[model samples]
Target: MKKNINITEEDRKIAAFAALAIVIHVLESSFPSPFPGIKPGLANIITLLVLFRYGWRFAAWVSLLRVTAGSLLLGTFMSPTFFLSLSGALASLLAMLLLWSSIRPWVGMAGISILASISHVMAQLLVAWWLFIPHRGILALTPILIATGIFFGLFNAIIASSIEKRLTDTV
Candidate 1:
């Protein structure tokens, strides 16, 4: 029989990844945003990292923790914002899986990050349009939000790519 190690390398990787995700989420949330939902998406870097290093399962865990803890700490618990964030996070994770599968490993981090960010923004907008605000004013912000989404998405992609390069060589 094979002996089971009490602390596996994979366990350490998972804990480190989750902690990094939470820290990034908190940092991003702390910074002031011009708009309600816009952030540098620093946390998504961890998602991309996990997707690249471990797999989709780890990536999904990162996303789930990021959103759940983010909402609770930001005091958006049980609100429409919570639901919207949850939807966006899940959509982003799904997009990451899709992009990761389709792209090469060399650029997988950037591709997955960008696609996930776009997916998250779209999900948030859809949730806002349908559930919270159905007014013209809310819809009017779509173009601006979309533009910001692209900008922040690309920013996160670059960061994720950098992190992937830096860490992959070491780990």
Candidate 2:
């Protein structure tokens, strides 16, 4: 017998969030960065918001969808960029899951966002070093990347929090 899976309205909501994330990702990609690997990661704001509002599952769906669809849309599917994006999303998801599951009551959006952001950057850096560069020089960028992650993570968390407040007010 074939097992049936039920799709609910929540699935549609998650898909909508994922689409928004993908759009944001693509738009962010259009801008030129003065340096490589210095993106603000604003698209992650949607994921962080969804995680705070819905749950980790919804947030994971949105984040992974954004990375996969965004990579495909950018014509980077199965390329180095795709791998890096996937690694970062997966790492961030893992970090968020751990933090949200254990210390959720104690920690807030800023804490989770900062940890996830650092995890994402670390994963991407490791992937880049292992797959592309394969040199000790890759380690030199760790401090800079981590600092950027912290800054952007806080910034994105603030944006997400503001959006959430507005949404709650309307509802």
Best by lDDT: 2
Note the Cα lDDT for every prediction shown. 0.78, 0.93
Ten residues in a row with the worst lDDT in model 1? 103-112
* Stretches of model 2 off by over 4 angstroms after superposition: 1-6, 169-171
**Cα displacement (Å) at residue 65, model 2:** 0.7
lDDT, residue 2, model 2: 100
Candidate 2: 10-residue stretch with minimal lDDT: 162-171
lDDT tens readout by residue for model 1, 141-165: 7777677777777887788778777
Candidate 1's displacement at residue 11, Å, is 3.9
Query: What lDDT score goes with residue 116 in model 2?
Result: 96
Error of 1 at 144 (Å): 1.8
| Residue range 1-171, candidate 2, lDDT tens digits | 999888888888888889999999999999999879899999999999999989999999999999988998999999999999999999999999999999899998899999999999999999999999999999899999999999999999999999998885222
Highest-scoring model, TM-score? 2
Q: Tell me the spans in candidate 1 whose CA falls farther than 4 Å from its real position.
A: 1-9, 103-107, 168-171
